[model samples]
Target: MSHIHIPDGVMPIWFVLAGWAATAVILYFCMRRVRDVELGRKIPLIGIVSALMILGMTLDIIPIAYHINMSVIAGIVLGPALGFISIFIVDLIISMFGHGGVTVVGLNTLIVGTEAMLGFYFFRVFLGVFGAGRLSPGMSAALAAVLSLIISTCLMIGVVYISQINPERVLHVHKENPLGKIFSLEPEGENKRHKIEDKRIDIETFAKTVFSLGVFGWILEGVITGFVIRYVSRVRPDLVLSEVT
Candidate 1:
């Protein structure tokens, strides 16, 4: 739900370059912090998580373009550093398939990876708050996923608003409901009237519209991630890296 679908040449060059610079610095520190033995252990896990995310992304729910990011689960299992690198790999590969523009891969990675890291840290926080013995791992996972997604959605809304992409161009309307078509971009000239109506919306309106759409997606992702994490925790606790306890 938080994925940026803006094509290359649409977003300004400076923002795209800044994305790359920021990602490079994160990768540098992550690489330096991880030990060789941990790296060797993480590579296989990274590959598995990356593949799952790619597959999840490729299979969208249509119209809404909603897909499971699975980034929170990845963050819990792989840790923030490797999770970020894994997201970079997934985003880059998908761009080659024309899923997103090549120029904006860096920005996409940062946005998505930030949520993954947030999910990881927030999972710990939520687990603590809910009380480890009182709350199951599944519930903790679900709560964490929702909180992380909320943060990601808000951050993405800010980025889009700041970029000044006409809210009219970025969103559309359906059946006379403005919020119905949040983030549903179409080819230029597809629906002039819809664009005209969208222009009437300000950034606050746009943010509210997108958040409404996001609520459903977040719930679905949270439930699925929660169950999956619970299963892994029960069957193979060693593979579950995050401190869900």
Candidate 2:
């Protein structure tokens, strides 16, 4: 739901290059850390999780531009390293389908990967905070999902706010519109009045709108994540939070 949908040409060149460089560095480290045996075992799990994420991203609620990311679930199952790889793959595929732009893939991957990392660590933290005996796996997952989403939302908003400052170029509007010429009798300050009437978006409005729209989707995903984690904990106990359980 928080993924950047803006196309390639819109973002400054420096941002695009930085995104690719950062993603490459992270991928290199992840590859170095995982041994051949562990990599082989993770391949199938990565595929399954990537497929689920891609599918979730494809469906959006039109009115709100919202969709479930399933980032927390992937994090819980795959942990941070493999989860980042999975998110990159998923973002790459989604870009090909025009869900997000190709050049922005690295940026999108980084943003979503943050969510996975936060989700995974927070899940463990919550478990520890509540103590093993006090909280169920479902409740722990739900708490993690909620907290992670809040953090992810802040990160995304920060990125957007940063992007808007000192952009590569600015277009100055000095010429009057053809429509204005045609409607010569239009009152002075009419455009400004109309802009105010329509409520031009600023940082405050954008932030409010984003969170307001996503709050419900986030909660729904949190509950679903809790249930899925609980099920996995019951059956394939070795796959998730095994030590604590």
Candidate 3:
């Protein structure tokens, strides 16, 4: 639900390049962090986590039109570095399936990876604060999931806001290109006011339609995530309690 759905050419070239560069740097650090750990057993864990996230991401709750990410679950079980790696794999695979544009994979990974890292650290903090008594851990996990989703949703909207700073710059439309005329930011000399008014209405409608009810979506995902973490914690507390590599 928090992922970008824009097509390949929608984002400014500079922003896209920056996203890829940042993701590359982060991945380098992630790789280093996991390099010393023995992955023989963790290998299957990564695959399973990745598969679960893909399934979660692909299924949308029709009422709110929101989808689950299962990213925090990955972090709790796999730790941050490995969770981030798993997220990258999920994002890459989903993009190939047209979940999002191919060019936006880097940004998607960063947004979702941030959630995974936050979820792990916050869950740890909350677990300490709430203690390990029965349902207490589940509450902590829920709180962590809620907070992580909020932050990640804001980050997703921030990307949208930045990309839309200058519509023409984002779309990279050229006056000389005939096809670019369709995306011209300004209306022609006559009837410009009417065109501008219509465009404004459309933008407003899109914003409200997509972002107005965002809170409900996050809360719903948070609840589901908490239940999952709670069950997993009970069955295999080691996964939830493991230190991030």
Candidate 4:
């Protein structure tokens, strides 16, 4: 839901370069942090998680143009370093398909990877707090995923604000509401209520519209994340809890 699909030449070149450099540094640290033996053991799981993320991103919600990321699921199962690495792989592969375009892959990774990291950390925090209360794994995960997505969504909006991108060019999504062609989701005609037509849109307007739509995606993904985590915990506690810490 928080993925940025801005094509090349849209974002400031300096911002794009900075994004790549930051992503590279994070990747390096993550590589250094993961042990060689551990890396070998987790390679298959990493591939599985990355594939799930990629697959989840392809399905848009009925009317919101939002898609699930399964990123929190990655963090819950794989731990932060591995999860970020997995997200990088997902972003790279998706960029090839123009999900966010090749030039914005770095930025996309940073945003979604932050979501994954926050998911892991917030899960840990909530686990500690809710453990005494006996909160179900599914419930804890749901809460964590929702909160992580909210923060990541804000971060994404911040990027667009800083880059001075208009809403139309932000995610570049288009849809025809089936309820009636009474309106389209293209940010055109009557749908101008959702976006600005000028080169530099009002950040407040963009943020408001995005959050209104993003809340649905966030909660839905959170539910999915929670259920997946619960299932994994039931079958392989070692994978979700033991190794993540």
Candidate 5:
């Protein structure tokens, strides 16, 4: 559910590039902060987590129209810095394999990384608020997953808006195409020809589609994150607290 499956050439170049630049900046800061930490031991764990996320995404549930990303689980286990890096690497590998477009890799990373970081922080906050109980961690993970999906959806809308809304340019392109005839139909007596060419991209329609497909998946993601976090809290609480203090 967390992985974006949208194809290449769908989103505008500027939107993709902007997402990449933002991701790069965030990664730079994350790396700088973690520079003093011991990364040798963490590298193997990162690889394992990345592989698990990839595998989880591949095991899609039919009829759901979504795939489990396991990004929140990674964030909960690995902490934010390493989790972000792990997700970035995973997205890069997936893009190379043509699972998603190469151009939108940064956007995809941002969406997945956002889920990871948010899940990590939310888990920590929930632990503090609920006294580190098993159930509390689980609740945190669930909330984080839902929030991450909402944020990613909004980012996707922005991409769609930028790509689809260009009145004058669209008109110019329509003038040069055979499809222009469809948009050039003359108006009848009482009814005006609905200008398909001039019709604005409906943001509400986009939001509705995203929300329809995403809401249920978000709930399922939350449940999975919650269960995993609860188990981790019981078996390996130290991993959860290592980055907090």
Candidate 6:
């Protein structure tokens, strides 16, 4: 529910490149951490988690209008470092199949990775603070899912405002492209696209739209994640918490 689907050519190059670089750095650290652990038995479990994430993403229970991503559940079960790597791998595989543009891979990785890490850490914290025995696994999973969506949404809103709404930057691009003809500074007598450009998107509008449509799906994701995590915790609690100290 938190993944960005801005499509190609919409986001600025700088934002995309920055996202890519950050993802690369995070992945490097994650790999180093995993290698240092020497958890040979967990390797197959990691692979299974990655495969499940890919399948979850590809299945799409809801249509495109409600874009749902189950990466948060993976993160909650897999821990942050492993979750980030798993999501990165899943996104890479999906990109090859043309599910999403290559240029946006970095952004996608960041968005989904953010969801995974937040869910994992928060769930751990929640369990530690409240005592896992006090709450059902389902509840923990749901909370983690909600936190993941909230964090991911904030990141995406920042990306959109920085890349799409800055007048100095957007104006420069408008002046250079054929899209300029369709979009202009004129207040009246302009086409629909031009009118949209004249208004410009502000943070409030961006937040409202993103959150309004997102909250329901996010809650639903939270419930599912909570149920799954709870089930896993009951069956194998060590599997979920062993890697992350």
Candidates 3 and 4 compared by lDDT, better number = 4
Regions more than 4 Å wrong, model 3: 63-65, 175-210
Candidate 6 C-alpha lDDT tens digits along 123-214: 77777766757355667668878987888888888777766544433334343346454443322223433333434467898789889888
Question: Per-prediction TM-score, please?
Answer: 0.80, 0.81, 0.84, 0.83, 0.80, 0.80
Angstrom error of the Cα, residue 4, model 2: value is 1.3
**Clash counts for all predictions:** 0, 0, 0, 0, 1, 3
The reply for model 1, stretches above 4 Å from the true place, is: 166-202, 242-245
Off by over 4 Å in 5: 1-4, 63-65, 162-196, 199-201
Worst 10 residues of 6 by lDDT: 184-193
Best by lDDT: 4
State residue 39's C-alpha deviation in candidate 5, in Å: 0.5
Q: Model 5: per-residue lDDT, tens digit, 1-245?
A: 44556676545445667779988998898788778888887788889999998887777776453687888888888888888988899999878878788878888888789878877877677667877554777787778777776776676676666555443333332343354433422111112233344455578986788788788778887888788777877798776566631
Model 5 steric clash total: 1
User: Residue 155 in model 6: shift from native, Å?
Assistant: 1.3
Residue-by-residue lDDT tens digits, candidate 4, 41-160: 799999989998888888776745578999998988888998999999999998888788798888999999999999998888888877834347778889999999999999999988
RMSD of each: 8.8, 8.2, 4.6, 9.8, 6.7, 5.6
lDDT of 1 at 195: 38
Range of the 10 consecutive residues with the lowest summed lDDT in candidate 1? 180-189
Could you give candidate 2's per-residue lDDT for residues 21-50 as a string of tens digits? 999998887666664444666789889999
Model 3, 46-160: lDDT tens per residue?
A: 9999999999877877744368888988887898999999999999999988889999898999999999999989988998998868987688878888899888877887787
Supply candidate 1's per-residue lDDT for 213: 85
Instruction: Write the number of the candidate with greater lDDT, choosing between 3 and 6.
Output: 3
Q: In terms of TM-score, which candidate is strongest?
A: 3
